[model samples]
Every structure is written in C-alpha cells, then in structure tokens.
Target: MRCRGLSTLAAVLLLAGGVPARAAGPLLVNGNGDPLVWGVNPIPFNPDRGTLGTLDNAAAVQAVLDDFGVWAAVPTANISFTNAGALPVDVTVANYLSYLGVCGDGLSPIIFDTDGSITDDAFGPGASNDILGFASPECGSFVPPQIAEGVAVLNGKWIDGVDSPSNPEIPLADFKGVFVHEFGHYVNLDHSQINLVEGFDDDPSNDDAVATMFPFLATGTSTPHLDDQVAVSTLYPAASFASGFGTITGTIFRADGVTPFQGAYVIARQVGDPRLTAVGYASGARYFPSNTGGPPAPALRGLYEIPGLPAGSYTVEIEPVSHFFTDGSSVGPLDPPAALPGLPEFYNGANEAGTNPPDDPTQSVSLVVTAGATLGGINVVINGFPPAADDCSAATVISTVPFTAGFDASAATSVASDPLQSCTFGGPNQNGHSAWFTFTAPADMTLRADTTGSGYDTVLTADTGSCGALTEIACNDDSSGLQSSLTFALGAGQTVVLEVASYNAGASDVLLFHLAPVLP
Candidate 1:
C-alpha cells in the first residue's frame, strides 16, 4: 500500500475470508440465479445483546439500526430492517452457538462480544485483528440458496476504551462503520472496488471514496458509496431503477484476444462528472451451477456487466485489482486476485481491442447509453506487457561489476518474492512490477546496488543462492527519497539475485540502476 503521509493515515484493516466465485458475479446468488435476499420485506433482527464494551445496550442497538438504515435509505433500493426486540433467553458466548440452527428462524440475532471471547470461541485466537464484525447465513436452502435466517457479531473490544496489550481499541467512530459494512454482506452484497486509490494510498481521510462493501475496512467510510448503493439497488431495485438506469456489457481479453481475463476491474466513468461513475464489477459476474453440483453454465469468464448506470455518455477503462486487496481482504469474485499482465488502458473505438499493442489512455471514445437499454459488445482487449525478467527464474544476468542498466517498468508484472526479506519502514514490504537480475561474484567484496535515478518510488532486495533456495541478504525502501540502495558482501564464485520493484502498484518509471564496489 502507498503512504502519502503518516499523520493523515486512518485506521484500515483486513476483512472477511474468501468466498467461492460463480461466473465472476459480485452478488451472493442462489441456485435459481437470484440474489439470496430476505423473502419477506422489512427484515427483522434481535439487536438487544446487552451492553457492548463501553457502549450501552441502547447505543449498540441504535448503532446497528443506524447501519441498517444506511442501506435502507438508498432511494433506489427497496429493503428495510426492523427490531424484533430481544431473544427468548439471553445469548451468552456459551449459548450463542446453539441459537445458530440450520434453516430459517425468521429472527436474525446480533451478538456483542464484550471481551472478544465470542470471536475466540467462534474463529479462534487473534481473530479480532481482522474481524471487527461478521454476518453469516445460519438458515438457508441449497437448491435455490436463499438466506432465510442470519446472525451478526460485533467485536466490542474494538470500541471499548480499555486498550488491551494484544488488541488495542479501533476508534469508536470507525468501529461503528464495521456494522454498516457487515450488514452489506448480510444483505448478500459482495465486495466492490472503486476509487481504489483510497484503499491503496493508505489515506483514510478519503475513505468515503470507497464502497462500504469494499473488502477492507477504512475509517470515515461508514456511509455507503454510490457503487454500494447501486449494488443494493440492483439486488432489490425500486420501481424506477430498471427504467431510469442503463447497463453496459463487455468482455475483457488478453492480447491474444482468444483468452479471457477474469477478475479484471472495469469502470464506467461519466464523461464530464467522473464522480457519477458506475463501477464495482469484475469481468464475468454471473453465478454458475457447477458450484452446487449442477451442470456448469456456458463459459462466461472475462465477461462483465455494469448496471444501475444513469443515461449518459461514459468512458470505460480496465485494470487489474489492487494486489493488496487479496486473501482475507479480497475484492471482486477472485480471492488473492490475479495479477494480469495488461497495461491499464481506456476503451478506444478499435475494431480489434485487445489485439493492439498499446491501448492508450489518452485516446478514448465516449459511448452514449440510454435508460433501460442494454449496451453490448464493448469488448476491451488488454495489451500484454509482462517484463522479460518478471520472474526470478528469468532473472537478467549481469556479467560484470560497476555496471549500470536501464529498465522500463510501466507495463511490468509483479511476481511473488520472498516474504522474509526485510524492507525498511515507511512503505509496503511487497514489491510491485518487480524485475529481477542475477550476478555472479568474481571476487570477495562489498558492493552497493541502488536505483539512484529511478523516476518512481522503488524498493530493492538482494538475496543469495538460486531462486528456489535463496537467503535474503538485504532489502531497502526509501533509503533515498523515492529510491532504494543497499550494501551486501558477496563471496568469490557466489551468486546473488537482485529484485527492483515499484513501491506502489501500476507505478512506472524509466529506472537507472547502478552497481559498484564499495572502497574502504
């Protein structure tokens, strides 16, 4: 993740675990191809879970209701929730599991884990770090999977002022937002990625730019984003939604054009007002039957559809999901999102989109969409630009010392590097658009390898031995402003592999690397 400033940073953390993908769709749909929603309108919930940490029971109940109201207030969505009072018996951590019976009970229960005991009992130790709250479908059908009943839990330790040495308090105001975020999942809405710079930049002041259903929780995003509103509206659209909004359908392809690129993010930005954009779609957003032991649906990978778009002229673009948004913090349909070897490009009016070498961002065509009309065949073919040394096995060989080399990482692809490598503070340890080089030491000496003239922020790592069996020797980030330099000793005949990578995703620059022996 990118960090612009330390003082401005907001509390941000990982969210729920991965869910199986079905045709790349964002909604949690049933076998019948419908989003699993409350069959009955005005979903009822038991919010009386007693006092939650420092917050009173009434405050906790009101907070949950306020979160539900955030979704219910969407003008385009026809969904609501009502308080069904308390459960028959007080649900302590010991008895909460028994209340979570299979099938619909009509009463959704909310639990307050004051001491995080419930989280430890439910998910195991240290779960509170990533889990502020979670919602699960307790009662549902498989044939046409519908959520007849559900339960939600909030980690009260997050708001309780008493800070534990293990789990510190996550600002009370920010903790309140988790309820809103978890509720989005309760209503079957999946994660959406939009204005992703906020998530990647580590600037929580602009958290409102992200969707509430975003895979991670960021401070200030308590309210839902336009994408979140659209998601809920699409699932339970009001009468005017279908007639007042438009849809765009397209396919994302590799440079080959034949191969589809699943998990690519597609955004439809309104021509003049970019804020009025329609996003939150991964290519191929449909549910497949194979996941439920039924025959698979027709191939829909790389396909994408963005609905709830108001009639307007918009420009569409495609890029890979942020690498940071993975695993427990995954976005779209694919967990641990795919690192597509495609340049970020805008959709130009090309007869053969992806086949072209360069999809220039400056050259784009504005497409006018009509309300209720489904615009099809907006296929975008991404130009492949994987760097020659994208992998460690293909490391560029450096024959001599006191060497300087040039690199263009604009369209480079990032590969997995050793996790144990030490990176300095002030930047993410992970490398983006990484390129590798191998050097065989001719003599015993101490040498300094640095990206002294890199146009963008760079991180450098050096390791000994082969790619599979290697020991990290040195790693540095921001040794110099927006550049990296590290010194290490190499024995005669020993080899070292060096990795130079961008500090942030999609960050590119013409780089100049210098390697020279250090003299005492």
Candidate 2:
C-alpha cells in the first residue's frame, strides 16, 4: 500500500504511515543498500503468566501490535506488521530462551521477563541498570556483527507501564518506549546519540529528545520523530520515495587542504526546524580519499553523504566530535580523539569566532537541496590548532563526584615515576602523549578509570602527592576492547590524582571514568 498523495512534511513524517498509504532523514545508516526488514510476521510475545495487567497476554499482545502499527502506518515504506498471537511454549530451553524460539521455530519473539531470574541472569544480576530491554540481531551487516535480528528481552520485572501509546510522558521507564526502541533494531535501525546531554554526564534520557532511535531510550521514544522516520523510510523505501527527498555529500579537511579528517560529525539541519536534523560523519571508512589527494593518515579522514532529506533549505554545520561520543552515545568502533586536533568551525570557515564571513552555514546563505538531486562540494576546513580549552593540562578538577577527561594529543603533558609503589607512575610506553587531572573523593567509594574508546591504544595511571614522591595506585594497558581500564579501591575524602595517556605512541584518543560504592 503506497500513499499516492503525501502532503505536508508533518503529514509525510508524523501521520503518513499511521494511515493506509504514504511516505519518508536524519542518517540512513550504512546497510548493504539492500532492503533489510523482518517482513509482516506476527510480532509474538510471551507474558510469562505474570499477574500484572500490562503483562497479561491480551494487553501485551495489543501493545506490541499498536506499536507495530505506528511503524507500519508509514506510507512510504513497504514494511508491514501482523500479530502472531502468543508463541507456543510447552517446554523448551531456558525460560527466556523458550520465549525466544530461535532453537525451535525460526521467528523473533518478544519476551516479558516476569521473574527477575531470566533478565538479571542474562545481564549478570547486578549489572542491569545500564540495560533495560534489548533486541537480539541474529543477522545483518553489523560492525560488532550487528544491525540484525534474533530475539528481544524486556525487563518486565522493572517496567512500570504507562498504558497510552502517546507516552513515556515522564522519565520513568515506559513499556511503549522500550518496544519502539527495540523494534527499531528489529528493522535493522541503529542507535543515534544525537540528543547527548550538554556536558560530561552524557545522559540521553532527554524528554525533549527528537529520535526514538537514541542509544538510551529517551522520553521521545513513545512516538517516532523526524530522525527515526527518515532512517526507517530510507531503509525500506516505498513507492514514489525519490520524488520527496534528496542527498548532500562532501568532505571535511584540515587547514593544510591535503590531510583527510576522520571522526568529525556533519549534519544538515532544516532551516527554521531545529528538530529536522540529518547527521553524517566525515568518515574515512567506506569512502574515497580527500579532495587534495592525501590519505587521511593515522586513520584520520572525512567524507560524508546524507541521503533521503526532504527537498528544502538546510544549514550544514560541522563540529568536533565531543568526548561524550564514547562515554555512551556512539555505537560500534571507538571514536575518541587521539589528539585535540582542532576546534569546531562552520563550512568554508565562515562566522569563525573572530571573522564575520557572510556565508556561515547557520545564516541565509545555506545549502539548498532539491528533490532527487545530489549537492556536492560542500567542503569544510576544520581549524587545525588545538585550543587550550581542549588541552588536559589546562583543565581544573572540580570535584571527586566523578567526571571525564580526554587526551587527544601525542604526548603526556607531564608524568612521574614513583618509587613508593611497585609499578612506577610512568604512563604509556608508546610515544603516546598524555592529559593530567586531580580530584577529591568526597566519600569512600570505588574509582573506575578507563580508556574504552580513546582513538589510539591507551594506558591510564592514578597517583597521589607530588611528581617526586607519587603513589602508583593504578596502571593498566588493555582490559576492555582495544582500550584500557582499571578499577581502583579508594577511601572517601581522599585526594586522588588521575592520568590519561595512550599506549604505544598512539593517535588522538579518548578516556572515560566512573566512581561508585564498593559492592558488598
């Protein structure tokens, strides 16, 4: 069923699919250019015979159907949905696995984990806050071998349901929101951390967030938004898909005009509509070399293409990839800076803090995209100098309340070799530069230091006192992924020193830290 007469952008975006026929940007992720869909299968659910009304078979089934309807209503997509009733589970593997008939029947099942036993066990009991509901990808083109489908598990034990589909009205975990988020993955849609909380505490449960596909299920997940709609539509485009959208492609460069700049993020925001944001990365992966002919050395390069944008005027903005990207927002490969290579700037260096170039991307001289047309040559040159604001040595440790520091540089600003501890406080064996910091642990708590996604290989060190008589409390190479991590036991009210240095003279990278009460 196709929407032969799609109307306004709102009509096309919000109401299009909800009706019988219709239409679709943010980013239409890198799927193999193939139509990745789950077909119109009965979205089955196993209530686990729970007493909660929300978990009852009928209500649970309807909930899944309603949410599926919300997505199927998209007029421009060929994706369809139907209820498969409850999955037959007379006897099977583990309780959760039983609900997920991957072993018995080849179908995706949504499990309502009534007892904490299954959900907690799957996530390792104590470590579930970082998770709520999850979609299992059995197949697809995934980086961590993802963007596929297998099974979905919802922590029914914790979900306090809010009946209305138009909900998640508060910050509490809403059932509808979780289903929508998981379904997005069921359709091969990945997470978009576009709604990153302004500062170091990269929480994404923003009530005002625009995408249902955000990494952390935000309040906005109850309903689809511009970002979600465009991405889904692009993947499963319907009839007449090309008549309503266009594409924007370009390259990101350093001042030298020859070096490719990788990891920089790009977006085409619709003029006057702050919510209409289309994101793309100036990436070296799956793209060509820079315009000046030099490769994005040290694995740094930038090239982008944003497709499925409604024909309209848009401001193309370029900015530095904030450290929060690795803190939790960004998925797949780590994108932390190896060096604070440059400050964020607009395309063509317009409206630079000091310069008043009339053609700043944010102004009237914006890029105009025509339906089905590809707009190229929208190149941007990032300011190559590292700003002091981004330098670790130039930072002030505010409190021991837990924070983050990034060292996207070549060498440690300064380091020490302590004789007081078995291992010297010496950091990173690699020509890897470093960043410095200090914090006062207000109370007795465990300190967790990490370099999960710092671009280059990493080595982190923690000490107290002066450089001459340092206490090498913690030091590590690799514990998580290609990054480094360390869990330090510290008492409250103690002053602790921290270091973020790369392993083996690595490239610009990022680091993360956390503090919590020692678990009994």
Candidate 3:
C-alpha cells in the first residue's frame, strides 16, 4: 500500500499488502486532526552522493532541486524548498535505515539507491521491481501536528532498467515527475484522484490532465495539476490564494436520501473547457468499512468540498473508483476500493428510489462559482437503478446481425448458474455480473460471438430455453488474449440467450460483444 501522510504524527506507511492504518483527506492532518504543514518556509533538504544510474550525482541532485522548484512556482501556494547540499555522510545500503525517521534533528535527507539493494532492504526483497519510490513524515508533534522534518527514497533501477530490460525505463522528464510526486508526500500531501479515468497510465493521451498527487504516475510531468495546487494552497495559502479561487461544497446520499455515501469521486469540470477541473472524495473516505464508521458523525459522512476552482460555470458528477486501482495502487480512503451501488451520474437534484428515472449525465445542471465564496447545499442523491440488462427477465433484445453495444457490469449482480454442473464458461464460483441479451435467427446459420474489445477479461456463453430453465449450448474463454469467443448454430426463428460475464469481480467499462453471421 502507498505511504500516505495522515493525521497521526508517528504513523508509518508500510509498503504493499500491509494494512493501511492511517487515514487521508484533501490535506494531511495531525494527531488532534488539524491540517499538517511545515511551520517554517523554505524547507531545507540534504541529498546523498549516489547517482540515478545513467544520471550522475550532479544531474540527479539538479533533478530533485528542479522538481522542488515546480511546487514552489505555484502562484497560489506558499511553498518553497532549498537544497542544503550533500548529507553529513552518504547514506547507502550500509546504514540508510538508520537515517530514516530521524525528525526534529533538523535533517530531512533524500537518499538515492543506484541499484535495487537499498530499496529491497527498506521495503523487502523484490520491492524495487514495482515500487518507484516513497516518502514519509517523521513527526515532531502530535497536537495540531506540524511537520518538523521528513525523508524520501528513490529507486534508480527504474531509470537504469538493468534488472529487468522489459521494464519501461523512466524518461528523465517522467523521473522528475516522480520526484515532484514523492516530494508532495514528503510535505504531507496525500494521494488525490482528480480527472481520473481508469487505466489512464498506459494511455499517454490523458497526461496533461492528471494530478501530481494522483495515486499512479501517468505521463509524469514536473508540473502539478490544479488539484495539487489547491491541496498545497489549502495548507500553505498565500495572501491572494483565497481571493483567487472559489469553493463548492455538498453532500452525497444513497437513494434512501437519509444514508450518506462515502468513497464516491466528486468532480467539478469546467463547462466549456473540460480540461480545467477539481476533485475530492466524500468526508469519511479514509475510514475502513466505509459509510458507517468514522470520526465524523453519520450525517457528515458523505460531505465533500472542492476548493481552488477558478470562477466559471461548471458541471458536477460522481463515479465509482476504478476496480483496478485498489490495494497498493489504491485511490482515496478505502483500500480494496468499493464501487458505487448505482451507475455513474451527475448532480441534477433527482434521486432514484422506486419510480424516479436513473440519474443521467446529460441531465446535469451547472452552477456558477465566484471568487472567495463557498457555495453549499449543492447536494446529490445518486440513482439506485441497476443496469437494464442485469437480469434475464430484463434482457435487452437485438434483432439484426453484426450488432455491438456497450455494457457496464460494475453494478450488475451475479445470477444463478451451476457453472461446474451445467457449464465451465466462467469456471466454478466465477463472479457473474452476467448481463443478458437476446437474439432471434432470421434463418438457420452459424454465428460467431466474441468480446474482442472489452477492457477486462470476459466470458461469453450461449444458452437455449427461458431464464429459469436453460441449457448451455456453447461457452468459450481466452479465445484471444483474455477475451472470449464462441460459435453456435441455430434454426430459423430460434431465439438464444447471450450472457456476458467476467473472470474478475467488479469489472466495468464497455463490454464490446460482437455477433455476426459466418458465411461458409
């Protein structure tokens, strides 16, 4: 798991698979739950003599200094750092751990491991394989915890690409990006999910929009996004910071309208230019076993506030955290993240209960934000409606050939299927968000069905007969990559049931199910 700086002063951030004991918010907090910040400005840091593989000592040191400049350059944030030159002695694998957690002694060191030895020593064996780097706060106080000092470590193997040639050797620019991000944590900033799209790291197109503190490093740039700027400004605001940006506050609720919903991503996107945005999780997001237990009262659990938004008309929406971004790569508060019970929707003042239509993005309403103002009561109650094709009884009908449609199984529930006895399409005990679709043959023909363009591993199955009593005709798995494909024969006027399911639980995104006639 990530080492997010939290409220407790002495709290330590353990690496992957370890329990995430600390809590997080827009800003890191102290023991008394006050926001944490450096009581002094121009924080001084000492660097070691080790090189980042190809980058010599001078180049590596300059990279760290330059990245610190990027954060100091934020016009609204009163944050600055100075390079205090080399450490008293080079901290290598021999005695690096001793230098860690040494706070209030006026030493904040940045150690560089030319190889994976130091990294493995600190985190464990094979840690350097995946972890880029990490930062931690060595607290000096607990009440209204103020950061006296901190420490950070960078693994050079990512840049050297020696251990694993297949591992993407980080570009110098992206390396600086990682420096800025780790420094963000060093200065007591937790991970923030803004302008988030699942699986965004592999696709560089979304690079410019990602936040510096986003859990995973996308196209790493030295520059911090608006979300990062606001977070820093919230802790170390300049005189003009407040007057320069506006705030939006609200509460998110379940269909019952009484129970608050936490862990939902709340985003405010500029109406005309969607590139400009800000995001936050609901108030109780950091609490484990979400929505019920937290330091905050039940009434305040789902409250969210987005600050540092420029004056403009903007639309707001809520979506579930991506299922892939859990555990070590977790986003927001809940580790092993939770998905929203309903579909992603906007704040249009309509909530789904029994009869109300499901909330839609197209129906979103815009609100005007002004400088130095806090707009409150912009509440939203998400629709409780499940996907239309969730059950066989509500199966969506397809009449023509070569048909393809998008389906989201994130909110779809598993149906009754004896996979071991009836079929092995998805293996025994496979999680079935099995969405249903129907097709009738115009004439007897062989048809091929496949989930070729799906985002996650899928299982495709064909069945004959009604929902209650059905026999599996054909099922396929891993026909191409992790996608599934199958072919079936049918007579004229015959109808077949198509069930699209996943091998992994809580899979979403467009399930591209393609069906076409096979000409012989």
Candidate 4:
C-alpha cells in the first residue's frame, strides 16, 4: 500500500521509456516449457512488527491457490531457520520447489511458512533481494537467485514490508489477497496493462482495488475484481477434466436501460461439486481474468475469450464496478469517491451497482456445454439495484462485497464497508448492480439463504436450480443480530436458485449476487 516516492519518480524520468512491448503469447522461459514457477517462504523480522497465526494465514494462502487452481506442492527444502545471520537463500529455494510440486506430485494444495523476512523482501529491498513490492522493476524482474533445478529464488524483504498473515503490519485477514497477486507472478502473470495508463508508476495504485493478481500490495480491504478472476480462469479452466473442453463467450449490457457497460467482468463457473481435483488444476482451470489482459478502457467494448475448459455445465456471471451512495444518482467513474470516510482517493474504474451482488438472492441464467463446443451469445443484462431510503438508515451496511463460491447471508458474521463505494452509487440509497449472473453446480447440490438486517428486513436469493424441498440454512430475525454465513454442497450439472424475501418488511431493500468457482 506504500509508494516508491521521489526515487521511483527519478527512475521513471531517467528511463523515459514507453510501455514495454506487450507479449503476444504466454511469457516464454528458456523457449521450452511454461515460465519457471516459483514461491516465497517469507522470512520474519526480529521482534516481528505484526501478529502471526500459522493456521489461518496458511488457510488464506491455500484459498488463493485453490481459487486459481495453481498447482503448488508442499515445500521440499528446509526453511525453518529464521536468524538474521542466515540469508533467505535456502528459504526461497525451498518455497519455489514446493510450488513446483517437487515434494509430492499429487499434493492437493499447501501453504508454506510465511517467514517475516520473505514478507519484507516482497515489498522492498531489505536484508535480501532489492526488488520492491508493487513497484516497477520488481524483484521477480531482477535476476532471481538460482539454487535448484527448475527453481528460482524469491526475495522476502519486499513482501515482508508489504504485509501478510505472517506479518502483523497489516490485517491478517488480507494475507491471502496479497499472496494471490504474488503467486500470479509466480505462475507468470504480469502487471495489468491498465496499470500503465492509470499512471500508477512503480507502486500499486489502490489497495482495495479488485483484480486477483493486481500489481498492488495488500490493504486487507481489496477484493478480487471481475477482471482478476476472469484472467486467471482464462489461463486455467475447471471443466478441463472431461475429454474435450468447452468455451463460453458473451457481451455485457445494463439491465437498467443504460448504455452497455464496457470493462465489466464476465465470469463462468461450474455449478456443482465445488471440490476440484488437483491434477490439471494449475494449468489455468477454474479461475480466469487475472492471467489475461488488464482492465479494459472506459466505454470500450471488450471481447472476452475463455478457453481451455472441460466440457460440462456452467453459469456465467457478469459483474461491473458497483459503488453505493446515500442519494439516488448516477454512479461515477471508477476513481475513488471525492468525498468519503475511511476510504482512499484513487479510481481504477471497475464498478458494479444496481443489478446484484455476488451473493444476490436470485438465479439468473444457465448454460450447458458439450465437449469441444464453443458457446457464444451468452450476453448479460445488468440490473441496477439502489438501496431504499429506509434501508440506507440501517445500522450496518456493506459497501462492496466479494463474490465467494458459497455465500450464506445468515452466516455472514460481519458487515464491512465496501472498499469500492464511490460517489457513483449516489449516496446511501443508490448502489451498484450486476449484469445477468449464472453459476453451474452438480445436479445434487443443496442451496439455502436467510435475511437479517436491523433497518432492512429483506433478502434476495437466486440460482439455476429450483428451491423445491430445500432446507432452511439459517435464520436471524433480530435486527440487532449479525448475518450468518450459508453453506451448501452443489453437484455437477445442477442449478442453484436465487430469490428475494423480506425478513421484517418495513422497507424494501435490494441485494446483489454473482457466481464464482468454489474452491475445494
């Protein structure tokens, strides 16, 4: 979340170079196989600057890999030593090996030790590598240390200072988000082309900005933007298991009768059985957007190509940058709101409002793909969902909500402010929306939802399957109570349903929903 300051400015001015030539294809290493994948075992600083929780942090990191289907094996090298006297050379080598599945070929997914030193090295030059986190000429761009075959050494200093679950400098909950970005690079993802035009310079522009593999460091606030997931999935498709893969293509439009919303994110996910096999996982399966191009130009109709998918059923969901405002008004550009509290001032232009949140209570559409078939014309019609006057006065409100595979409103333990809430949503009453949303699940998956809000008493639910003979996941009638998280198991070829129902019925409120791959 920190910038390079005058030093970076001087470097850019001195170079005066145009944007680097965009690679036409995947970055090649040694002209042989895919790019050499690597990993980091962040070294810790003496008297660690922040808190450390091994299990939760590891879970967070694993979640990132699981989402992208990145094949990361258990670490092979020994990286237990943490003394400052010992350089992080071994630690880096070991971590990279782990990512390569050197330790065990069939490892589901693993999270290595997030040493403090590694975290620092990721952000900037510390006792180890000189690369700066989220800055141009990053550590990975430099000559990576060489230790073993097919392994590259990663400096932890930059990452140490940047923030992670292993480091207490920032919120531990966000360690997975930052690691997701770094891991994207480990799998050969580069800075988004959009960052170049945004004048982000050497450092990342926004902490909470979306993009699974965004170039920025962790702010413990940002969620994976639509582009982020699409890129990753494009590189790896979940449906690759069946004989031949299928393709789903589509355009996104505003359901509110506005112009087509360019730069929006369209994600297609397999509905049933959130659990994905480890094999063929890292090859860019279930997740996309991050591994592809950067954010599209404003008003520019962008074409999305999702390839390398296994033939099966899928639900495609399109989410645009959505922001919330107190009064009903047009959502502004992606820039940070000029006026807001506890929010930074910067805009990346990815906003979704009006239609549905990732967890909206409604099932939009469905698609069935046969092996080797390229399905097209899967268009999305986004419906704007602004908050009601009474709903705006509620005690708890969420500005931006990340799209998770399984979202249970009753199980929502806490309500955090949407980091992307710019003035565009038009005050409290106005909010963002999603184009038509779709999700694919196994035929036998069970879905459920509930409504719980003090000021607002309604909840929306939707999906591809009918809610006939379904069980109630959870219920909280007390307005003062917090929302609970929902849990459901979906099977392949099954559809989930979403609909809206009022809990208290004092005032009608709107909820948004989108679909994403559920990590096993």
Candidate 2, which segments miss by more than 4 Å at Cα? 1-35, 39-54, 90-93, 98-104, 139-150, 160-173, 198-206, 251-264, 275-303, 318-345, 349-365, 379-520
Q: Model 3: C-alpha RMSD to truth?
A: 9.7
Reference-based TM-score of each model: 0.71, 0.60, 0.72, 0.34
TM-score of 1: 0.71
C-alpha lDDT of candidate 4 relative to the true structure: 0.30
- In what order do the candidates fall by lDDT, top score first? 1, 3, 2, 4
Candidate 1 runs further than 4 Å off:
1-27, 31-33, 101-106, 293-296, 389-473, 476-520
Q: Count clashing residue pairs per candidate.
A: 4, 41, 3, 148
Model 1 residue 510 CA deviation (Å) reads 20
lDDT of 3 by residue, 222-278 (tens): 578787887777778897788977888888777777787876778888888776465
Question: Which candidate's lDDT is highest?
Answer: 1
RMSD of 1: 11.5
Off by over 4 Å in 3: 1-27, 30-33, 161-168, 198-201, 285-300, 350-355, 358-362, 385-434, 437-520
Segments of candidate 4 deviating more than 4 angstroms: 1-183, 186-243, 256-258, 274-302, 320-361, 391-520
If the candidates were sorted by their TM-score against the true structure, best first, what order would they fall in?
3, 1, 2, 4
Cα lDDT of model 2 by residue, 1-520, tens digit: 0000110011001111111111112211222212234433433433233422246656666677777677777665666665544556522226555444244354456666543345457546532333556663333332222222345555544444542322112233345776776666556565553433211122333354445665554444567766666666766777655667787777766655567665555667777664545543334332222212223244333566666678788767665443433322343122343232454455643433322333333343377888878898676665544321223344446462334333235433433342222222263242335555667765565666665545666566777776455577887766766666677766766766655554444555334333322222
Which model, 1 or 3, shows the larger lDDT?
A: 1
Ten consecutive residues with minimal summed lDDT in candidate 2?
Answer: 3-12
